[model samples]
Target: MVALTGTMGEIPPGGTSREFGTAYFDGAEWWAVIRGKPIMARWLDPIQPLQGGKIVVDFTTDGKGLSSALVIGGYTDQPRPSTGIAQEVIPAGLATTIVFIGSDGVTYTTDRFIGSYSPGDPIYLTWDAATPTIIGKIQSQATPPPAPPPPPPPAVVTGTETLLVTASDTWGVGGWGRWAKSQNGGEYVYSGFWAGQTLTGSWFYGAPRPALQGKTITAIKFWIPAREPVGSNNAAATIHICAHTSSARPGGDVARVVGPFDVVVDPGFQGGYVNLPLTFGPTLAAGGGISIAGDPYIGFLSRLKDPQVGKLIMDWSA
Candidate 1:
């Protein structure tokens, strides 16, 4: 039996079509077998088999996972099957074609898909050629599951928190960004401490800070005393606020917690406890540190105390 792709079209002028695969017969002699049975041989072309034309086959689908009808090429000269029912079954989860041979030797098929067919079991196929339309049986009868429950409300901020976390001034995510002096007074972290920048900067870089565990950070405050702008050059800084989980040095990518604002110092730079707003910031886990960084020639204050009071602030909830 030849395998057919089940699609067809007409041959163009001065040309032949090969859609028939190997199905053909010259002068009314179709010579092909399907499902181990000889099919009617009809004249498709005037010349040899599969020469001037091709056989056409097409199909249509029905419900979920099922096919309804199939259009088969004609093969004349053989008596039409009187049984009116034919089945071609495949493996499980495969569709079995139920063929109905019409009185004119034309074969049409409607398929009943096996959803979970068992192996070694015979598939039933009973169809009438006169009425090839058969509504497939309901393959599955299992009831659907219930919908899921809704999520709980979000946690609200109840109070405030303030802590002096170590600050650092680093050019990038590279080594501690020039951590020197003391880890306690190393609250100043500068983002401008590259090879060319001078060490006269006023930032601190040291070990990570205490974790604000379960506390939602609101802002980080820093101190910048009044200084001479003549040596400032109207310079600005991009402060990178972070919350790290490491005890060593904090990296930007792994611990950044929001507020990375830009600040420019003009002539009358009011030096006070400047807050890097962390509104709607993330919660700090255990062992988390806070730090900042900026561009070249900019210094950030860190680790504030009662006198200086430059520190990290947050909103705490139960």
Candidate 2:
């Protein structure tokens, strides 16, 4: 059987030209008959089997164009199928050609057509011998599952706290008023030994105040009075702040040691109590009481006090 199919431009208002052809026939045998009159015909062939072929013609109309139609009328020596349809599965990324004999004793072909596709893609092609066209459609397959939801963000912990002077103790002193002094109008622990007198005096210790527990101390501020005893030139003292395991006086330094910050009493008792600020490393634990030790130089104030009224600032997540 022969088949013919092709696209055509829109017919003009007056008329338009169209053509068709096949490779099976010689040019001399082709003819165009209109109203019982023989008209000249053009044959574009000598084409290979299953290859495209064509015939050319220009039509003249009386202000009316031809209607869309398909005409199949031919005689062949060999018998052909009356009607035929075929289906084929084409894989992705492959170009293929489809050829089949039609009911009109003509061989039809869809020369090398490619359907660019992704992995696992399949194209369903349906060929109709009457239309002489192979229509292709992508097969329906399961859609990939949606990407797994992004992992949840890590949990965050946040809080706030404060470090306050909980409890204060004076080292090397028996009675309260004896080894204590008033500084900035607040009672503070004092070391009341003059310079070179066995170097004896009092030290101060501070722990978290009541109602403020589990607070991390970030910084501390205190006051110390430096006095120049008679006949002494610049009397200096070294203050040490150590982190202890407990609130008692003799606990070991489990957390850290701050410093031996020096306090100088110039000649003639030139300096008053100086304000000292110490920032802790990574914030001291409130459970570990901070120990304060003082080592005084000759003529340095021994009876002076170290204030326990310092701010113990802490931080927590809200």
- Would you list the C-alpha lDDT of every candidate in the order shown? 0.40, 0.37
Misplaced by over 4 Å in model 2 are 1-139, 146-152, 155-158, 173-187, 191-238, 248-286, 297-308
Cα lDDT tens digits for candidate 2, 1-318: 111111223445556445434322344554443333334443334312221222234443343433332223322345434332222333434445555334343445554334433333323333332233434424465333234477798665444444444444343333322332323323343333443322222233345443334433333443333443433244344445444444433432233345434544445543343433334423244345444444443322332233224333444321
| Number of the predicted model whose lDDT against the real structure is largest | 1
List the RMSD of every prediction in angstroms. Answer: 21.5, 25.7
Error of 2 at 254 (Å): 12
Q: Model 2 compared with the native: what TM-score?
A: 0.32
Clashes of each: 13, 22
TM-score of structure candidate 1 = 0.33
lDDT tens readout by residue for model 1, 1-318: 133223212222333223232343456666444333334434334423342223443323332333321224533345433222223334334455554333333445555433333322222333332234433332344222223356678767566655443443333333444444224344443444545543322232233234455555545565543432332536543344444444344343235444454555555554566665554244233444444444444443333422342344555554
